[model samples]
Target: MIDEKEHGDVMEIDKELMTKIYDLRRRLHSIPEASMHEMQTKAVLMSFLRENTDLEIVDRGAWFYAVLKSSDDRIGDEERTPIAFRADMDAVCGQDGKPGHYCGHDGHSSILCGAAAWLSRASQNQIINRGVYFIFQPGEEIGAGARLCRDLIIEKNIGEIYGLHNIPGYPRNHVLTIDGTFACASTGLEIHMIGTASHAAYPEAGKNPGPALARLLLEIEELTEEYNRSRGFVRMTLIGMDIGNANYGVAASEGTLRMTVRAEREKVFAGYVDEIKQIAQNTADDGGFTLDIQEIERFPATENHAVNVDKLRKCAADQNIVVTELAEPMRWSEDFGYYLQETKGAFFGVGDGEDHAQLHTAGFEFPDEIIETAVKMFVGLALM
Candidate 1:
């Protein structure tokens, strides 16, 4: 447990530090970049670290990490395992169809930076026993960032990792944690059927994939229901479908069906995907069309370790932050699951107030008030 003096020291956020952190968030918000294209965003964060802290920054092209080394001789061997905190640096498109900070990634990155600054200050007067890594990851919006960055955990031999997402519809500054699966596993499945086109007047002269596509939809619905009943929570949503264009003279010959599939467990998720592919293949064969299936934007379930959840709860309690235990796993997915697969860690949420604009909306902007709360929690976790 963190003592009162240590808690007080970590919780003290002066006026200047708060202003700097807020400014950094605003700067990041203004210059939003899409997944795998956060070059400018990376530059700004690296510049801030160089200007504000003395920690070593290692650039890994798409992502980067800042290190805080501890050199206390009194540190015990058990307490020397390194820990890591991650903040995604990618943004999603707003309603205007352009990239923007509609998911509060700016706030997440800024909070990590704030914790880095505080850790730098704390190390000067206090003896930090273990090293900490601050990972500024990219491509989270497309579910590719953590897959690339999880290597750091293996390379550094990190004992635990932590990440947080700002969630609206809850009271601001409330820290949210779950013991098991924190987020669901999800992926995009696209089925394409190709056949020969002929004159619409003689429909039987050509092969039309419309019937096969419609039948495939029904089969998918049945599969979803079966999985939901037998397995845990499972879902499938038809995102889009295009069965040829409106050329009146030509018969519809090719089509594409796109849907997102999600499940609470990885095994169930994979089984559903395999079943979907088989169904599509059978439908294409019966309809006399070539079939192709592709998976995109894949994300594994963000399963939190039970022990790490306890540590996070304890840290929140030490920092005097209210923590809400989540009743169920979030329907959305997070790439941070890649890290937890390799190490022990927890992915949590910070409430952005009940009245705040929902994420991925045009009017959504990250609330600056939660910066201190997140920073204190992260710092306390590091010290723990």
Candidate 2:
């Protein structure tokens, strides 16, 4: 047994079992799959759950979860609400020119698995008073994972849900959470402009939208200032711009503008989108160009329920783990926000270490040292 006095809330972590979880993380690390393409990874997870746990597997096309139902005899008699835990199972393309688990998703999945294994082992003893669901989500990097599983959450009547990401720049093992938004909402916008092409020697014969594109870019920046001043969290970034073909003999007939917009709230992001569309349409008309706009990959801000935040803090304290109340929501976006929209919960963060390599970088690796801490934290919450 790990001493509770030294480690705080972690009273009895199984060392041998934890070693197995670390090995599982290594296996997952070796077979990194991106976004919705997690077939092989899914197979591995399925096999592990089948052979080692008694939980029922609920498989959707791109995502799956293990559900541990409470015994019927103890159902509503117990006042405890059903709790859910989520772990993202997709990897990201890293700087090494290959797909890898640089975001520590491998660790996250293993932590959930470890907690599930313990719950399964302890269920026979009736340690848990209510049902528990362990959700393995895909496409979290592309911001669609939780949305895809939204139905499952609703069907199961999950009373509460929780998730965590490993943060590399904070003190190791510290748990960080916020009361309101935990991350920002963001979406990509693509604007395409089309015009009649003609010979460069007779450029006046063709409608050139170069000037219009320039004006729109400038106007978009100015609009961003207004939104940021009023909303306090809006930001727009011009990612790329393209016009015409490589051939120099013809006046450019087409152009494209790509940008990303983000804000702390969905309302603010919607406001940004509406204004962008208005500006694009006006500019296209003024320049005599036809326009097409496309919205790409979107993630809402991860907002935490106030009660969930308190629960997380109490759980961390029970595990003798330190908890940090974040002053503001992170500017980055997460699809985990979708879960919060469906149920009451909080998506917290666990510190990897102040000196650990940053996420999505080739040099980054998930540290094994924090695995037990993560497992204990989740298990503690379920017990609560």
Candidate 3:
């Protein structure tokens, strides 16, 4: 626990600093970039850190991390192991067919930068005892960022990592957490069925994939029901389906089915995916159609370490922030799960507002008010 004076320092946000951070958030909000393609987004973050703080910034191609070493001279192992705070920098494509900050990533990045500014000042005053790293990642919208960046945790011997997302429906500034499986494990499954084309007049001349596709959909519906009954929460949504072209003379010989599968447990998630593949294979074999299956945007369940969750709760309490226990894990998936697999950590949520627009919608915009609240929690965790 932090002492009274330390708590005060941790929660204090200078007016000028707040203004700077807010401006930075707006700047990041203006130039939203796509996942894994955040060249311009990275430049803005790097420039902010370079201008405001004297930390070592390491550029890792698509992502980057900035480090503030402790002033303490202690050479112990615990001191060497650093804690990391992460923020995603990439944005999602809006309804306009252009990239925008629909998922509040711009605000998440700004909060991390605010924490960085605070940590730098605290380190100079010898308030921070251990090293801290600020990781700004890209490609989170498509589940590719954290996989490419999680290697840094192992390389630096990072002891604990934490990340947060803004929840739209909750009261603003409420800190939300769960003991395990904060977010569901999910992946996109694409199945392609190919058969010989036949003349429309004589459909029996060649094989059509329509029958196979219908069978596959039924089998998938059954599989989903079976899993949901025995296993934990399992959900499958049919995103799209397409059959062969508009040629009137030709029989449809090819079909594609795209879906997203999600489960609460990683093992169950894998089992569900395997069963799906087997079902697709069997349907293809029965209909004598060639089958092709691909999994995209794969994400493991974001399971939080109990100890880290406790730390987050305590930190929120210290900051006088409302701590809300989540009743169930979120259905959405986050690539931050990759980091938790390699190290002990927690991913949490900060409330945006009670009636704020939902994330990824056309009207969604990140609330700037929560930046101070999030930064204080991060600083408290660092002190702990």
Candidate 4:
């Protein structure tokens, strides 16, 4: 816990602070390191956090945290569980080698850092009711960092959590409180279709897996469309397709299908997977194809805590920011969904820049305009 005497109503982040944050945001954008490989990112962030604030800092190398203790002396120690704010600090891989900011993780880190500065500043005058935890995690591009941060957050016994991402199409100053479908559920599966090896010229001597694999892909789409229509809610997608043996001649034995199944509920997720597997297996069997399959839960559906959703709505109103209550939940997946699984926390997206392409595209950059707004908003919640 940070020294409480240093906390309170004194927290304020003005224009000059916003400038520093904007510069830092672009600087990180230009570097564009992928997830779990954010060493330079960690260095720059640690330097900034140390230079800008007097908060107690905890560095776990890949994942670091900073805590600002509340100034209230009358508050019981048990109620002092810190409020956590998380930002993933990594870029996506397997891109066009252009070093893109497709997901605005670069922006996410900068905002969280700025929020830390604001909280530190707020700790100066009046006592905040709960401590603040600033979490900067690495390797979120592959969706592994949040699970790693989840343990640390639990170890610290954080009371409530909040997280943010920059979204496409939303305007600046719009604060969203997504009550449901804030994010979607997904699982990654890798399927290998196998066949016997034979010379391409002598294909008749060997069993070919190509026809079987092709049938599987076609059937998957049909089955998914059927499921989507039946439920009228869930959506399934085959995100990847690779088939045939590396060799041209050997009656290509090994093929792989990588896909994600998304749904609003676990039951929907279960139904999607069970049906897909059965259809695929039956298709492969008829085609004389051998199958080696592995499906891993990639991210669970992120449901906002009811009270948190309400509190942040009030928090936005208190900050005088425009609120857009979502009519539909997002279909994208976030590892932060893991944190919400373990604690009462909320993750919301900030505005996407003008003409913004969807995340993971090379043509993306962090917008500097909203930096101060986010910091001030979190500061409002912290000091309340």
Candidate 5:
């Protein structure tokens, strides 16, 4: 259970700014946009920055990052590394099949925006040591948005980055982080097998792929078990399968199998994909059938730098906020993995409370109270 007493200091929010942040979050929630299609959300954010902050904006298609330079005159005399904070701005469809802010991205975006507002209002002399960047990313659900921002990150010479997600079932306002791998690599695979269709009465004249497909499925299961035993992690799920149509009197000619492959390491995930393809080919060849394989989607594992993780812990402790080190990396995948690949950074989680609905659920809602907590964490990281 979360220690409620530890939340008091970290949950403080400026009443006036809280109103604006809430308004923005609700506005964003009302008009939810899917992954690559966040035009309206982008416009709202840009308008807010123009009206409220005096930072420079660099647009990159549906995403953008705002830069706030430090007041220190040493900027030109000596190069100082800029720190970046990223927030995803896209909403996703809920279990009810409707687009909404069930994933709490609306809240996440507002928290970052609040930090930007604070930085904008601070006096020039206050930002002396390091520059700051706030990145508003889109298409996180499809796992392409973070990769698109790679060029901007490289061009700006950002030395380190930080990210956050609100996780339910933990104590409200508490921060959780992990060392080393934070999330697993995942990808969807599709396999198609083709054979000759024939009348059911004359089964001998036509080739039915039922037996072959069954064997392939068993092989996949065995492979998953073997990988789990060897690598200590594997999640292979068969999400879809179709052997033939409803025609009762015809022998099956076409079959399809779809599955998701996940592993803690990128190499292990790649090996799983390759081995699955080989199994598909060998099975098809043995049964005199044609086989095809396709990858539906892919996301790399998110790894946290030990140094960054330690910094996060120190920052949290300094603010009197509770921190928990996770025992294992999350099995889910995140697009933010791409950012960590190029920069020294860490992605941590803030608790949304034990009673809150789980993420991606139809009833899940981003609690507005956590906005202040997230803003505090971002501000702390920026100044650290």
Candidate 6:
């Protein structure tokens, strides 16, 4: 049995908690670790989790799974139906060469840590339904980290789960989410144009791969527009055109283009990928270039659970939270979709203040005001 008084007795989502969350976010932001190299992040999260819950902490490389139990492994109705709250803990490889917290993942981590601490202190009478599992996930930006926790959830018998991510345009101290607004499918794509290297003087010998890459990039805009019209949620972006092998002496033998595609529906997204392949093949054929297309990461789309959606909707309603249904759609993606794939859960957005610059971009800071708003909402959801 949890100590409800212990949970309720402290922190009223006041200035103190806000300061803590803010400080945590900043500290994490300063030391942004990319993808699976989140050892520092894992250590900090484990320290926080251990200080908060009585649950066993299982640290497996890039992921940590903490299970909070009730009645100490009993039979019948006493058996805990585990619930999970997860937060992704990887940083973006910012363009500035400085580790950046532009993704607001740092904030997401602090909020989850805060929630775990608060819920762990809840009273026996406050143990409304079942067990609580705090999942501090690593390497979400790279797409496969959640796979690290796949077996652990099934083995631990976790029933339902939920996760939170921050949104840029939404007002701080408010919440914005529509049940089916977020796209669950996304991937970062890289296609390399490889050809024979030859001396610049021998124009007939070397196939400059740069021209093929140029053609490929030009065609992508049309493909993106088509996807916008047909799939609406499916979108593609070509990010890089790297042909730096410039020396009037040697013909460019290899070129590369970095791209990403995102979609609300998986099948539609698959169609886009197939279409992209066709485009690349045709482009390569004409330009005498060989293409090496490899996906950097695949982040599956998130489908909100019917039950969790209803629960959060009601909770937000009770709190008079501001809600926004997407006018168009967002191309951003999250790995939290992995948990939703396995269990009944939903990933949601909390406002980061309208003025805040977009996430994953330089100059974006996790808004200080949103900290309390997030903490309160988690408390409300947990206690309920």
Instruction: Work out the TM-score per prediction.
Output: 0.95, 0.94, 0.96, 0.86, 0.92, 0.83
> Candidate 5: where is the Cα deviation over 4 Å?
1-13, 73-79, 95-97
- Model 3 gets an lDDT of 0.90
lDDT of 2 by residue, 226-307 (tens): 9878877788888999988888999999999999989888778878889999999999988889999998988988888999
Name model 6 segments beyond 4 Å from true.
1-30, 71-80, 181-184, 197-202, 249-252, 285-288
- Higher-TM-score candidate among 3 and 6? 3
Best by TM-score: 3
Give the lDDT of residue 320 in candidate 4.
67
Compared with the true structure, what per-residue lDDT tens digits does model 3 show for residues 1-384?
Answer: 122375434466777888999999999999999888899999999999999888999999989999999776652477447899999999998667699999999999999988898788877778877889999999988999998889999988899999999999999999999999999999999999999998899989888888788878888899899999999789999998899899999999999999999999898999999999998999899888999999999999999999999999989887788999999999999999999999999999999888999999989989999998998889888888
Better model by TM-score: candidate 3 vs candidate 5:
3
Q: By the TM-score metric, which is better: model 4 or model 6?
A: 4
Candidate 1 C-alpha lDDT tens digits along 73-100: 5334555688899999999976576899
Model 4's alpha-carbon lDDT is 0.75
Worst 10 contiguous positions by lDDT, candidate 4: 1-10
**What is the per-residue lDDT of model 6 for residues 324-355, given as tens digits with 9 covering 90 to 100?**
55554456777777777787777778877778
Which has the higher TM-score value, candidate number 1 or candidate number 6?
1
Return whichever of 4 and 5 wins on lDDT.
5
Q: Each model's number of backbone clashes? A: 0, 3, 0, 13, 0, 13
Writing each residue's lDDT as its tens digit, candidate 5 over 279-381 gives 9999999999988888875898888899999989988986788898888888888888899888889999999998999988878889888887788788777
Residue 307, candidate 1: Cα error in Å is 0.6
A best-first ranking of the candidates according to their TM-score comes to 3, 1, 2, 5, 4, 6
lDDT of 4 by residue, 1-384 (tens): 122333222334566777888888888877878667788888888888999888888888788888887677634476566788888888876446544667888778888888888667656755466778888988766668888888866787787888887877877668866886588777777777776767888987766666776677788778778767776467756777775646765566566787777887656777777787887788678777787778764777777888888878777776567777777888887878788878888877777654667677666666677776677667666655
